[model samples]
Target: MRLERVKEILLQQVEKGKLFHAYILEGKNCDHLAGVFANAITPYPEDIVYVEPDGLSVKDKAVMELQNRLSMKPLEGSKTVAIIKEADTLTVWAQNRLLKTLEEPLGDSVIILLSKNIENLLSTIVSRCIVFTVDEETEITDLEKEAKLQARDIGEMLLRKEKFFTITKKLAPVLSDRDRAYAFLDALQEWYHKLIMVSMGIYEDDSLESHLLTKERLFSAIDHIEEARRELNRNFNVSYSIKNMLLKLL
Candidate 1:
């Protein structure tokens, strides 16, 4: 969903007094999105509390501290907004403790949890909150979906050791346009992210691409594609740069 659209939806809930006690926002720009949502819901600065991990993880102490602060009456707005950045970094013990807060929410208070990936969070935590997965642009996401299909087809061809001419034939449309080439690269990046998640055992994908790529290989591929994209931005020949990227991948 677009950020503005999600904001509107939440605002509607607020207007109707049907606001959810908690929300789980997961996406690449979720941190910024959460900040914007927090401000939109609670304009009063004093009523908003932002909690982030100081070290590797948010432990029991941090959750307890948040609870203590939340216990106090709001000084301004009727509702206090609490945003937990990197909620995935919360320790298992901390999540258990935080679960109590979710189960029995403070009256008229709202909690927003921001995470790049919801796979890292406990099932119970996710189940309690309304989840929203968002992208920066709905238009770009549609393009990415189309570009992603092209990428997958080419990937399958490469894995099959198809002739360069055959693969290049498949790349004709993507390489013909600079914007399409960039979108193609962006689609590969999406795959790279999934590969990382697969490596972490937090996500499952039965695609051949998942079985064919190692994290190191995927990272190197991303680097090559990004360099080619930089070249394209520098006014390099679109077809040549994209074809060169394919060569490097092969």
Candidate 2:
């Protein structure tokens, strides 16, 4: 479902007081959407339990910790929300341990699992939760349009094996503007995401770029774009990160 549609459904559920015990929010930008959903439940920060993996995987210990927390009543509100970020990274044992909670959640508690991809999760666990897949496309601003065009152009150049100097020159001006640089990175991620959807026959834009690229190549592009975004978020040098990402893409 599109993000907007998911929001609408969630709102209706909230109004009717018919919220499920568990929900699996699956898609890119899920972390952002999860925040929105969490706020909709309650404004009290103390009522929300945000869980993140200590490392690559959410260990069994973390799941046990969550289980212990949920055993107690809500600290501030009638409902206690537990948000597990990057839930796909949960280790097999952790997921298995979480299964019991999903199967029989504590009083007035909601467990929200956010994942970029849900396939990593067990089918039984997935079956126990409400699943929402985000695929929303909003109206783009002029800046975003320009950024997307630049991303497409750079992608084409990279695919054609353009010279390093040429690619760097095209990207330099974009990196110079901080706002546009972030937009460019976001557009780049979206561009590759669209390609992946097209490759999977889930999207039907039928553009030359989508037709020319394979799923593997699209995944590679998306991964590089995500890395660049993470670097920029961490205050890495903008130009350096973009250049590094472009080189990795090549």
Candidate 3:
């Protein structure tokens, strides 16, 4: 789910005094949002218990400690919130211990499991919690925005049948910063995805670029951008990948 949607749902739940006993925050980068949600649900720091894995897995000892803590009353607030960071790292034994607590949670106690990869978690445990997937686009930085705009301009130039050298020159600045290069590819991916959507009449946009490109070409663009992203992830030469992607896209 989108971050905004999750926030809205959380707000509504809070306002109605209907917050769930457990929630699983899952996404590539949802740690920050987990912290935010933790604070939002239980404003008092003393009432919020944070459980972080000390090794490859959340040890049984830690789970036992958490269970003991949860058994007590809230120190200062109406609720006691436990945020288990990297929840997917919970060992089988730890998970079983947690499952018992989740099965019969204390009144006004909330357990927030934050995991980047939910597949590692037990299905039964997952079933007990409301899940929210954080959208990475929600945390776009200023640098990423600039890179995205530059990438869109490059796409527009390619659609205009501009010279390859000119387009390559336009991407020189992005090549210097690895983060910007990845960000540019991400932006290109989004751009082509939107174009594909527009072509299918599933989305409405005023961009003439989308109207001008054929569905086949838009699909090809998305493929090339995704390939570039993979190359970047593999530590390929930035300039070469960008040039190759532009050549294929054009």
Tell me how many clashing residue pairs each candidate has.
Answer: 0, 0, 0
Enumerate residue pairs that collide in model 3: none
lDDT of 1 by residue, 1-250 (tens): 5777766666666655556678888777777777777777778999998888879887888889989988998879888999998899999999999999988898868899989876577756765666666766747566677888988787667656688888999788887888889888767655654454455453446774344566456556666766776788789999899888888777
Candidate numbers sorted by lDDT from highest down: 2, 3, 1
Whole-model lDDT, model 3: 0.77
lDDT of each: 0.75, 0.77, 0.77
Could you estimate the TM-score for every candidate?
Answer: 0.55, 0.55, 0.55
What global local distance difference test value does model 2 have? 0.77
Between the candidate structures 1 and 2, which one is better when assessed by lDDT?
Answer: 2
Best by lDDT: 2
Query: On residues 154-208, what C-alpha lDDT tens digit does candidate 2 reach at each position?
Result: 8778878999999988887786777888888767765665565455443346565
User: Over the stretch 1-250, how does candidate 3's per-residue lDDT look in tens digits?
Assistant: 4787667666666666666678888887777777777787778999999899996878889999999999999899888889998999999999999999988988879898999866577756765666665667667679777976896798789888899988888888887778888778767765665565455444446874344577556655665766777688788998888888888877
Better model by lDDT: candidate 2 vs candidate 3: 2
